[model samples]
Target chain A: MRTLVDGQPGTVVPVDDRAFLYGESLFETVAFRDRQAPLWSRHMARLDLGCRSLGFQPPRPEQLLAECRKVLPESGPAIARITITGGSGGRGYWPAPDAPERRVIQCRDWPGEIDRQRSAGLRLTISKSRLESGPVGEGLKHGNRLVQVMAARECARSGHDEAVLLDQAGSIVEAISSNILLVVDDQLMTHPRPVVSGVGLGWLIDQPGLDLRLRPVAGEDLARCSEVLVINSVSGVRPAIAIEQYRFRPGPTCRHLQSLWNEQLI
Target chain B: MRTLVDGQPGTVVPVDDRAFLYGESLFETVAFRDRQAPLWSRHMARLDLGCRSLGFQPPRPEQLLAECRKVLPESGPAIARITITGGSGGRGYWPAPDAPERRVIQCRDWPGEIDRQRSAGLRLTISKSRLESGPVGEGLKHGNRLVQVMAARECARSGHDEAVLLDQAGSIVEAISSNILLVVDDQLMTHPRPVVSGVGLGWLIDQPGLDLRLRPVAGEDLARCSEVLVINSVSGVRPAIAIEQYRFRPGPTCRHLQSLWNEQLI
Candidate 1:
């Protein structure tokens, strides 16, 4: 993977990048095909929402697309990472009177190899952890990610591939990194938005004939679901077969959504 | 300001610094005095605690001390920053299996002199903003500081010097970066635990004849306090005169604490 700054071969961030000092940054991961990135528009919109939340000016779309063009992987499947920070010289915590630098980075290939699970599904465990979010930071994905890190660590130590974090309101929010979708009878059910609002899953839920409902989902409700699926930019849609003791077999919804996910990319 | 990496003047940091990626780092802002840092031990302990909480190994005390001596500022006050990230590479969220790279930075001196209010005190407006913390991250002072940044911006726009952010429980936790101490009915009380376990103010509250109680302080209870003081390494202990409409004069307790703080520094 190569790194670039403003469409160059090399770049190092300033010492005072707000993302380094205060986590005053936003990031998005997109999937790449050949040397091109799919879902580029969706990723840009999310990154812009994050920038708007931080009150930082985002870079021009043409510039961003140009940079992405230069650094996207030339071969194989890769992950594109774009990060923007409230750049150098912020007077301690507040944004300075002057404009700050904007940063963009695109790296090739997610270091993680998940093809095995993509074909065979993954085992998920319920997380005791909960996500705390409100209007201030609910929809936007800024760099304040320690809680996500905590949940991820918990998942690693608990011998599971991922964790299903709940919210303060005793409802399942989402997996630590992806959105959660459970097939309930003939309908699709996911937790309401008191927790994180997953960007990818939001679109999937909007697809017609899905019969999606936003309701408070508890652990008990999982036993009643026909199947469960998780979605993310890199992982796309994959079946979740086991949530701790509760088990599930791949069902029609999981297979259908997976096909739709692939179709959308094309 | 002198920038050093691996004990020499260096401008480039290895992309592998955990602090750069996951914010798997901790830092301290030591008050520089004539080429010496007075609160070095306390600052170092907090750094060690941060590493401990996040499960990162810390630098040897002698190694850190030597680095501090090597990079002490030439003149004026400075903010000493040391960020340690769980370095090395892996696809998953688990910490890399290696001794992490540590980043040490010492700002020669804070740009643009401190506001004149360090001694005269500044008006504070209790913010509707709140901190994101709980049992896991309560007082580690790890790199997840976007909450503080958000509160600082709120202070700037609202025409206040600083903000007192509430916790998830709606209990007054702290004033963005400092510990909040209140003189209530001739008693000094502070919120306990997850609000903030600030090192400097925690030491001050331990002095004799100090009726320091760690309790959940509601917004209403705080606005009625006799005198409110915010404490940190830079500010020391400055008595807050008013919060919104509630007013406070320089009470005896405030003066006493100020003297004690001065004596301790001397």
Candidate 2:
């Protein structure tokens, strides 16, 4: 990966950084096309809200963009990860409030399969690894992602493209790396609890004609939905081929969202 | 802090390391006295269990010890932290199963006030930040410690020595960095759910005469306990003087445990 730690071209960060030590940090993954990140503002807004929630002095968006620009490829498509962490700290969980937050910006080659998988429809499996709700910074895209890591591992071993995580109450929370959207009762909806406010999902729901609703999705509801889709900043929008035994064809709504996504970013 | 990355003297790790990227790691904090780590074996045992649970090939205890010794102080008291992480990976949560794990060992000067505080007792306050239960790898001392960080911040800001965390059901889980033991109904007990399975607490309960029972401790039960204590490898054992409005004096059992700890380590 091409990486920068605090704007310098490097791939290492101080081991004592609280993010490395305790996972006390926030991050955003953006997809850049021809050096332009269409969802950059939404990603930054989420990061800023996360900083305030976690009590870190928010870094200016312009400053973060400058660092990201340093590592972002000048042409074609790429993936940019912006990580903000409280720098090195003494041996404890208590962070020094005045410590300057550090940023690690990394750029990676866009996954070549994303475009092919978008229309092909990705496979999704329900994972035994559940997302714990009510942890501090619940909806924020923070660094404490072991749950997702484990789920993703399960997906890889099971030969599925992604894993859908449920909550303790058997409610569908999200996929390991994306948010869930489904057409139930012919209404477009997403879960209201314990999920990252996905940048791509946010953009999709905010489009001029989409009437989006928030509802708790039970695990059993997967089989009932006519169409299921997973959305994220990196993957944009993807139709799901199957969620366990429940198979979903790319329905009209799914194709419409994909077209909207392509029109904006492709 | 004196440090070593995989037995080599360094304070930085690759930014792509899953430990830094996704909090996909296990860690143990040990207190070393005169270059001796009394709880080293227990810590290693916990780390081994964690590695197995997380599907990482566990590093040999001897190798980890050699790395710790490289950074441990030649004499006097110090704190040693051993972190094991799945090394650098690509742009997703699915860890490469064959990737070699990395270890970071760090040693720090022991807090000078620990000896004074052992007998003086620590003040504990209930925190608004609750620990989420049922996340995969629940009881492992993993790198995802944001919940504790937020609780510790609450303690530091509230002028208390530690903060007590409760699970979603309002049951007492543990203090910010330690496990809780209490004398309720004149029987020594500890909560059985969603805690780190503290090494120091294990040693104490294993002593010849102490009978330890596992029970779920409700938040309302603090006031009914005869005495309350917190235990961890780094802190050894400490009497807690208060849990919010509930006051606890160092009772006979607490003093006996303290004497046993000193006799074995000091």
Best DockQ among the predictions, by candidate number: 2
Docking class of 2: high
Q: Candidate 2's residue-wise lDDT over A1-266, tens digit each?
A: 37887778898999889999999899998888877888989998999999998888888999877777778778888888899997777448888857888888988888988888788999988999877775688789999988888888888999999998988789888898889998898888888874688888788868997888888789898878999988888888889999898988999988888888889867
Candidate 1, residues A1-266: lDDT per residue as tens digits? 36665456664665566667667777776677775666677777877777777777877766776776677766777766667777777676776746565565757565464666666788888777667774266766666666666677778777788888777666677887788888777778887773445667766766787778987688778888888888877788778889988888888887788788778764
Model 2 vs. true fold: TM = 0.97
Going through the candidates in order, their DockQ values are: 0.48, 0.82
lDDT of 2 by residue, B1-266 (tens): 38988778888998888988888899998888888888888898899999998888898998888777778878888888889997877458889868888989888779876777788999989999877774678789899888888888778889898888888788888888889888888988888874677888778767896788888788998878999988887777899988889988998988888888889966
**Model 2 Cα shift for residue B212 (angstroms):** 2.3
Q: Quality of candidate 1's docking, in CAPRI categories? A: acceptable
Model 1: residue A217 alpha-carbon error in angstroms: 1.2
Candidate 2's TM-score on the B chain: 0.95
Residue A203 in model 1: lDDT:
68
lDDT per prediction? 0.71, 0.85
Q: Which stretches of candidate 1 lie over 4 Å from their true place?
A: A110-112, A194-196, B14-16, B74-76, B92-94, B108-115
